[model samples]
Target chain A: MTNCAKPSANCAKRLVNSMSVSNDAKPGVNSYSLRDIDAVLSAFEEGRLTPAQAFSLFREMGPQFEAPPGQGQDAESSNASRLREALNELDSLIGLHSVKRLVREILAFVQIQKKRARQQLATEHLVLHMIFKGNPGTGKTTVARIMGKIFRETGVLERGHLIEVERADLVGEYIGHTAQKTREQIRKALGGILFIDEAYSLARGGEKDFGKEAIDTLVKSMEDYRDRFILILAGYSEEMNYFIQTNPGIRSRFPIHIDFPDYLPDELIQIAELMLKKREYKLDPWARNHLYTILTKHASNLDHNAGNARFVRNIIERAIRRQAVRLVDKENPTREELMLIRREDIGEGL
Target chain B: MRRCIVLGKPNAGKTLFVLHFAEFLHAKEVTIKFQEPVAAPRKGTGVDPEARTGSAACSLDPVSGSDPGAHGRNPGAGFGPSTSEHFKTYKIQDAVRDLTGPRPHTTRCLQSVVLELPAGKGKKTVELIDTSGLTDGIHQDAEIRRAMSQTLSSVRAAHIILHIIDASKAGKKGAVEAMGDVDYQVAAFAQMRGGYCILANKIDLPGARDGVKKIRDEFPGHIVIPISALYKEGFKEVKAFVLREL
Candidate 1:
């Protein structure tokens, strides 16, 4: 083989693995197929082939090269499997029990409707317009993104990406500009999800405000697109409830309402650990206790929005920075010195 | 539909690439939407006779609101009534020849053509937008300036950005000469976003191989796809990138 094909030990390892998989498969299978793909990829990386050639080669390999079980069956089932993988990912998240259950319910409801449609039975329309009431950084946006992917996987949406916007993005200056701006956003979110953060603000600035115009435009788009796109209006629980109650039209339109409660202290700690683990760092016992104590104090402070996952994320990130600062001068730091976040680095309260 | 907006300096073969890429994707007929910038709403605002002589004026029926046929006499210089929206449906061949030429700033507005690519199981429709060329300094022409701002807005909204650079220019000299300050600024801004790729165009030209090499060196860590946009030689990669992104 050319040196280009074996650029790194990683490539050689994948080749060995592919050779094993090829051997395990029935005879007559192309044993060199995976290696061929790696070779072409490396060649393209080295500027030996144009993108057109690489793409055609990739397309040719799509059918002939068999991926190991659970990797991906084929292109046809990839979308569905991708959706399943996303759900698995959601389930793997630290907390949000109620959120997971609600997602499962939506999936089951959609699947049943699909079956009913196939059987010629009368099926109810799936109006997925949702109101997500939560404090800041409570995984509302995160869940909405995953929901977009899930909806796409379940055939509810065509393009399951998320278009996140705020009141400023929707409400424009001038008389007719707000509607134009709002409609532009709606048009962009057509085949996916329109996530309106701080959505209650759309009802603020009085009845004559351009926010009202944006709300009107949004309502019209909801009716026009109907099932074409999913609109998720997210905000604080109390404000969102008030906003919905005042606007009778909004209350009647959004059928699904999900409330994200603040994460408990233990959950926050779990989240911190996960975040630290992801970055190849670990919280020592002393730092772990410090984090738990800080989280408990903050959660008990009744500031509801005091510290959630975002707060944990900030503290962990800060600790990582502090750790780096503490060790940057060392000639050769040990593995533990590099990976550990100590108690002193926790700093004072937020 | 996801939007893949094409942006670059003037005469970077953006129009040719859009037309040819659409054709390569098997578009029988394309519905082109020309979103004329709201700037310069007045009639006959910046028409200059000096720039009107080189190109031939071929009159077709007005495709949209109020007759814009008044400028048919001086087609090159007087793009009259460009503030109003227009739609043109054309076959690939006619579009390729008519939309692309040697002149700079041929596309003065946001012109988008919708094309579909067959994804794994289904087809994905994306609007491939062609915009006015960007310059390093502020352009003196009001129409070009308006279109430049329009292109910038489209850049912000686009999920996938294909930054087309003239490889022939870069090949002969260094990237600093071939690319402009605006090109670097645009690339720098787009670097933070995902689905941004640099297309080194005019690879069929004599010096383009070196230009592609220079582009790769200049914009390290960017996905650079080299192609002769005129011949649609590297469309498969563009297609794959768009499909993966969308």
Candidate 2:
């Protein structure tokens, strides 16, 4: 028999009061069921949910399920939730607020649609297709995740999820094979978002290319499941534009294009700091200045470099690794001892 | 069988055109085969479809023969009993393996039905060869340039050439300039010396008419047809045009 906790008015009142307190105490915390969390994780695995959306949803649910004494239910659930949230938020460990804002807007739209559905109003304004055109590491995946959250919050999606995939995943080795593979990916991303990174790679061939089969399948599915799924095609701006125009079906379905601009040097530094903080470490003032100078030099040298947060994070990691190796004792260095990443740590001419 | 090749520039709906054409043939209950083959297995343990079926034979293979019309019906006549027997158990896996193979040689051996209406006659079977788009500028890679050259060499023998233009982009300043440049190159090609039909694709877009008009104005004597390749619009008109010209 189902666990029948009577719909007691007192219990409902207590629930409401607890919810209010949770909301007031940690506005960032999300309140979601275990099923919802599973859906979000599945979406991420399937490339339908972005990391940001998963993070935002988990954040909202963090404080809601407090441990009840002896039952041990709340503690286990809370611990699992915190672990998932930490991993999801790790993507944002390198801050790019512009990308975050874009993700929030997507989530907001999902929430609005959910409200309409509850009121029995038709959802006419929901965006089912989006295009992310930018250089690599511009946080396109991050934005896709946040959009998933917005969808969950708005009630457009039962469980907001984001799945990230690539051309190789969708395009098969053969003509008929590509269609089936592409279909499977779509099935995996059902009722959620599917992000196709380097989407233009699907168009990088001639008449007999298997990528064409994937494109044909994607177009048909997009039309058939317009309400249930959203597709985000991301790649280098110029190539992506050409890729869309290559197929008439793609051009019609994906009308909205979101451009992700490369980060400036200052933005890169801020991202570097965020990465350091995530590890519970702080940079010495001089070390920070030295790191910033190295980033500025490298950013100017590389043509395809987007001044991406990932690049800064990677450089910081390298510096930390160098510092660790040079330390008096390589193993078991305390946080304070490792806190000051030096100029020498970054290495010469890097 | 007679081979008809489809050739054009990048982003000119070449792949979409071929896919839709294949679908159209499939709807008519015609057997179609693609030319390109998939790469070999990583560990080399299992047999791919291309190895099973004799269909992966090169277009110029002397043993397989060039006449697909006769060989398509009687597979044994060209490639011998052993090769023909293997093809009997042909699956879609083989078709995909063939389609995905990286052939440095730019030969494509596509087979599809050609619905032709000559006066009061019904549709007939005709093989279609869909080749890679021609890149006009100097290729940085010598291998790619050679492959493209080989593909272009085969186009001279094609019964028809489908020159697709982006109708929506035709009226823009850049597109207008590009159209002029493309027209000169295409018109100058000895392979397309006889003449070619211009397919003004993407007519579903707002500025398609203006683009088509610009092309028509620029090349008054050339045969130009407007179409929305995505929506399958003007496909009948295109089919009729191909039938008459071929």
Candidate 3:
């Protein structure tokens, strides 16, 4: 067949005129030709259509004799690739299995609902409201970040992000001021998870306390954004209970409770070793046992201080210093020698 | 039932003291119930202009019921309705209801406890009112100030006042400094023409001995007792003193 391709200057001018006409149309004008093309292109970009399917659809639509040139394609592809990279990074960092399972299940459910929406099938709305109650340094913040990623993966969120706040951020000094501060924090955390650490501190003072205003505002926002936003309140067990019970309004909404128990003695030892390994240091069996013993003793003595990774970190630093001081003229001791930490290195009465 | 108010500053162990007092009263075989605020629809009508507003002008109805203390005098009449009112009205009804309902002729005398312990005593039903602490940090707030003022006005109603101090921080430089700061508020309550007792809490701590001494030296006339609320130390002495004096 003879090629019919030809440079038509009049056609190019008509294409530009058509582009301007489409751009200048009234907001609600039914420009079916341009609208259909845009819809098909968006569907393809969103991965609803494969390249072959898009090509077939493009052919079916037929080439417009007066179509204008489009803008850059590289920027859009790079953005999609960047989002994929972020999700992969998050997936690798979060290690808790149960937390991961919960997040994946939520994401899968959301995807199912999205597919159902496209099919116009009857599907119930899914609401993922969760409360994380645990002691400090137990990966509450990390879990929140993973949840953001999971939401983004499920298409519930366009860009997964997390915002963490404390009692000081929400509370105010004067009456009627705490509500404004709490509302501002909610706005900052609008499209993502809002994490409130030490939330129990909000209930410290009596009725006249301004913290009550923050609580009221938080409860109202939670109701207002039940679909889009997730609020995670965390603190000591007893204090969190008091915080929830202090206001009858808050007690009802937050029902899903996930408790993170203190890490076992062995778990703490393993964690310490992991931390040391990250720093390119090896722990001898004796040193590991010594660290475990100290952690166990401390855990037994105090109701708190359990699963406190910080305590282990401090002990590791002390042990490292002792080892450094005890080593004589040995230049870069062997791995075994470097790993071997004696009782003296742990110090007395640890 | 006798109602007594526990008034102190922040960190003065008011909440802890109230918890212990409730436990103590429960151990004494007294059936204690916490009364929540009564929800009543607001009345649209205004008070009658002819209604008596003066305290002295108000007359006590001379109806001789089983409650011997009912018509004596309403010490809390002038003060407006507060959270304490729930406890007060509940105690009154709880005390007198058994006497009037079904067991009328059984000589079942009802003893109501008010945080403001009235001067005269019949059947003693004690109510403990845990007032907000009157410390320097909290004294600046208008609401706290008003609550403290209202609490002080009703202080005379209690047969005994327990002044709780933080023994652990007693003799430190900041502790000693804060003592002088709260001296005015303390003097206002201590100088009141009413019975008062001092409690040096946190005795389990190392410096509690010196703290007790400091309090004893500062407020000489009032009775000072060293205690540890957390450890439940010297609580028996406190209970004995309350029973003996009030």
Candidate 4:
């Protein structure tokens, strides 16, 4: 009944609907007994009552007779679960324990600061200029992209796109050219994450280098646009620490720092399994053994590509291609044969 | 200014409704702006119905021509982008005798009258447009086909739509006022916009009540107001609706 009360004119329709339901049970459902319906019809006939009033009379007859439009996803559900979708993607990564913990802490801090502002309390500014200390193929770029989605869902960025740039993309060849190039990239990164890979290389040149001009432009724009964008400087741990020590202006502005650690041999195998599961491909026992050997051999090497998930991803993708080639001459491959990556398909080199 | 258009089948008394509505708003003199018809622009959407508002307002005797199609059918060449318009002002009685008739195509061009309604502290201008009647299939006359095309374009752009349905003849299947695919198309198109109402016209005649009920059943979730356009009945509710939207 209360549901019908919400829409006043719709009452007439609701009452008419319920009156039919009562015709089976109540013996008084005859013409003379329904004086209320007669009144509504007469008012409707004379054009004396507006559409809303007539609908309300319909509603006044009855409302709570049936289940209202059952078990569907209503439009007004909270956005928290939608935001959790991005976080779930973040959590589902095979490794990066420390990175996930730091992300949760940063989100908690930002949420609390916003709630403080809502209550008229003194709130901290959300300066999430981050420094990512990691090596190549260590999931730094991937994490940056996920962070962009999370920040956009949290209302920190209008467009959660990631724009990747290196020192060459930021620094220019001539005088006054570096700032122009850097500002253009910054313009593209506004309302998104600006990921500068191998950022320590920006300080590799002498004091009079164009890289200095690029860094200065970045620091100035960081303050000018303040919360309009997020910037993440990524490099090796030692080099990034040294670079931060040399540039005093950038140290205080970058309040959050996260480290993308290399995966262990076991975690690397899990990542390969997750990737294969996502592609709907599977490894036979022998091929799985071959993958374990390849991963364990590279586990202690500590090279630029050692203990990296990207290396495993490339191997899986190449093996899939090799499997496709192996099956092309056959009359028709079954679904299992088509999806299987065999022992002969695995190769260390491209 | 937001446009509120009136559309229906021919001889449905759409012209009478517009004039009586103007008089209902206390309009003493009605200045009509008519855009001369061009070759029927390739049918409908995204095409601009070039509604040429009058630049020169020439004075005419209160009663100028008794012929309904005199002002609209300017025999000028009908191509290109340049569109000419004709304007005339008339008292309510003069407009009724001249514009409204039992014939189907009395209004052959895009005719609009700008009326003001009191909003908050000032008056808000609304251009009330009367369009040529639409038919279901291929029209015999090319000029009417052009006018119908113009009506289609105007219906797409107008902010408010007042679809006039002839209640008296709605029960008769073969009559001009019978519900057709064109009426359904208008209702379907207008459902997306903000202000759209169905005025079930000619309610003073018999069989109109059943017709109104049928209209309500056919197009559920629409506001249907039964009105006798010639008698000026139920104009107050329409005015209130227009003012609320304004």
lDDT of 3 by residue, A1-350 (tens): 10113212233223323443554455443334333443333322222232223223333344332111232425436655764765575565424456556666665676676567445578665555567777776677777886776565444554457888998899888887799899999888866778888888888888788887787798888778766577888887778877777667676777567676667777777777777777777776676676777778878986476776666777778877888888866787887777666667877423
DockQ of each: 0.02, 0.01, 0.00, 0.02
Question: Which candidate achieves the best TM-score against the true structure?
Answer: 1
Candidate 1 C-alpha error for residue A85, in Å: 1.3
Give the top-scoring candidate (lDDT).
1
Compare candidates 3 and 4 on lDDT and give the better one: 4
True contacts kept of each: 0.00, 0.00, 0.00, 0.00
Candidate 4 lDDT, A21-115, residue by residue in tens: 45444545433323343334332322223223443343344422211123223321444665788899899887899999999998888788756
Tell me how far the alpha carbon of residue A313 in candidate 1 is from the true structure, in angstroms, after superposition: 0.5
TM-score of chain A of each: 0.79, 0.68, 0.69, 0.77
TM-score of model number 3 = 0.44
Q: Taking the tens digit of each residue's C-alpha lDDT, what string does model 3 give over B1-246? A: 333556544555544554454444443222322211111111211212232122211011123322425434333233221222211222323333332222101110112233321111112335555554444332322333333433433443445667777666666655422353344345444444344677887788787788888878877777778877666678766765665454
User: Where does model 3 sit among the CAPRI classes?
Assistant: incorrect
The root-mean-square deviation over C-alpha atoms between each candidate and the true structure, in angstroms, is: 21.7, 29.5, 35.8, 17.8
Measured with C-alpha atoms, the lDDT of residue A27 in candidate 2 is 38
Model 3: runs farther than 4 Å from truth? A1-97, A325-343, A348-350, B1-246
Per-residue accuracy of model 2 over B1-246 as CA lDDT, tens digit each: 234556554456654565465554444332344332212221212223342233444443333344456545443221101112112112233332333232322333332334333211113334455554444333343323323333343444445667777777776654322453434345434222443678888789897898999878876677788877667777777666555453
**Candidate 4 collision pairs:** A9-A55, A11-A55, A11-A58, A11-A59, A12-A55, A12-A58, A12-A59, A15-A58
Tens-place lDDT digits, model 2, residues A1-350: 11114322233233333433443455333233222333333222222222223333333333233221233534336644743563366345455555556555655565565466445568655556889888777777876786666554443554458888998899887658888999899888877888999999888878778887788788888877766778889998889888877776777777567888887888777877777887866778888788778767777887567467677777788888887788866777776776777777876533
Task: Please state the Cα-based DockQ of model 2 relative to the true two-chain complex.
Answer: 0.01
Better of 1 and 4 by lDDT: 1
- Candidate 3 chain A vs. true chain A: TM-score? 0.69
